[model samples]
Target: MSTLPQIEPTGATGEVAELLAEVKKNMGAVPNLVKVMAGSPALLKGWLALSGALSDGVLAPAIRERLAIATAEFNSCEYCLSAHTYVAAKVAKVEATELEAARDAKSADPRAAALLALSDAIIRGHGKVDRTVLADARTAGVTDGEIIEIVGNLALNILTNYLNNVADTDNEWPLVKPRTHS
Candidate 1:
């Protein structure tokens, strides 16, 4: 039971059309992923609300995307990795080099490097971390507040990462750096 759904555009009316409108009004287009999720009206609505709220969270847009990419990468969720990598580069201003490093485990940005490490630790189910990781995070200017937010943000990505893995959602090519093939 893959997550992808075959949609009938004409079938979209009433509640479904309204939902599509909501997406289009905000995103200028309704993404295929959202349309697939919309198969369950409640799920579509639930994720939409969560997305809206995440949009308003204290984390910078770039950091939020970074967390998402790291989680997806660690989970080996190509679906989420492809999607967020695009957003990170296109909308969130994440650098390609940083994203590549994250994928290859060679991250360069100190703050993002710390986050990539944290993401790996969490994904690998590491029992504990050395004090130096925390020290690195501090030196990278990641506040305790940000750390808490990172955990919460990573949780959000975990949900979607797992969903996408289970779903087998079709790839949407990179909108950021053309031909880079993230």
Candidate 2:
């Protein structure tokens, strides 16, 4: 039900084709979001570069996925929620309960819990988390490097969330239905 068409890697030409190939090679498939983003070659390349750059950041894969899940949940992006949930469980090896906790923006680990709380505060405060929250995160063992990476991860997830929302990106991964709170 996406407003944009998903481009098949084989059908793409030039840079787009090259980028799609790399994506497939790395991801084992061209996710629907990437396909839709292929409509803008620059976006496709930039997204890939940003994602690649973050792969070696201070944060662990599980932590990154956790942040992604929480951010996606906050944004109500079903596509991202579904995709990251799959990534978290399969690629990152996050526990099922941890995955659920991430989607709820809560973590059992003390440091992770502090970081998640800060993430929520940032989201709710429109990226202006108060001084006390940041200090609390530092006290919880979140280093400066990790804090920077956390912000980067948040920005990345927000970009994907916005793209999925605007494009109505179709889910190509196992579907993760949004949590309903009555």
Candidate 3:
């Protein structure tokens, strides 16, 4: 059960309704997370603006989706993990093994692997990443623009992950359990 009211598009009015309409047009449905966010019209609008802007960033769609999953897994946000896993498989066409690797932040592609490592470090370090980490990403051929975009994407995931964590949002798709380590 969501801690916040899940505002349906039909029930919403004004800015909230417009935002829900946009979400439906873009994603084919108003996801429950978005519905929860709709409780605050400003939050929904801000989320949509940030998401739309970052969608045009330099990262490939699969890589972005993979990062989203990795962030969700790292944060133990079950809602985001399940949602992004669906997007990764159905929308991004990421392979099963690749999806698993991505969830672990260990992509097979060297460049992607580097970015994933940086992303994990950013989360673990709480954005106080070490200089060596940046150096490694650069050595792995991550450009300045890519690095900025990586942080942006990470911030985006953090918002959704934190929101889901706080809201205890119900998993609307097949549930993805948090990855356990030995």
What's the C-alpha lDDT at position 169 in model 3?
Answer: 90
Candidate 2 lDDT, tens digit per residue, 1-182?
99989999979999889889999999888989999999999988888888888988888899899999999988889999999999999999999999999987899999778878888888878889889988999999889898787888888889999999889998878888777421
- Better structure of 2 and 3 per lDDT: 3
Give stretches of model 1 more than 4 Å off: 1-3, 6-10, 104-106, 126-139, 175-182
TM-score of each: 0.77, 0.95, 0.96
State each candidate's clash count. Answer: 0, 0, 0
Which of candidates 1 and 3 is the stronger one according to TM-score? Answer: 3
- Which structure among the candidates has the greatest TM-score? 3
How far does residue 139 in candidate 2 sit from its true spot (Å)? Answer: 0.5
Which of the two, 2 or 3, has more TM-score?
3
lDDT of all predictions: 0.69, 0.88, 0.90
Whose lDDT is higher: candidate 1's or candidate 2's?
2
lDDT of 3 by residue, 1-182 (tens): 88878888989998888889999999899899998999888888888998899999899899999999999998889999999999999999999898999888998889889989998888889889999999999999999998899899999999999999899997898888878421
lDDT of 2: 0.88
Winner by TM-score between candidate 2 and candidate 1: 2
Query: What is the C-alpha lDDT profile of model 1 across 10-94, one tens digit per residue?
Result: 5687788788888888987776677677787787787888778777866778777777776676677776778888887888877
Q: Clashing pairs in model 1?
A: none
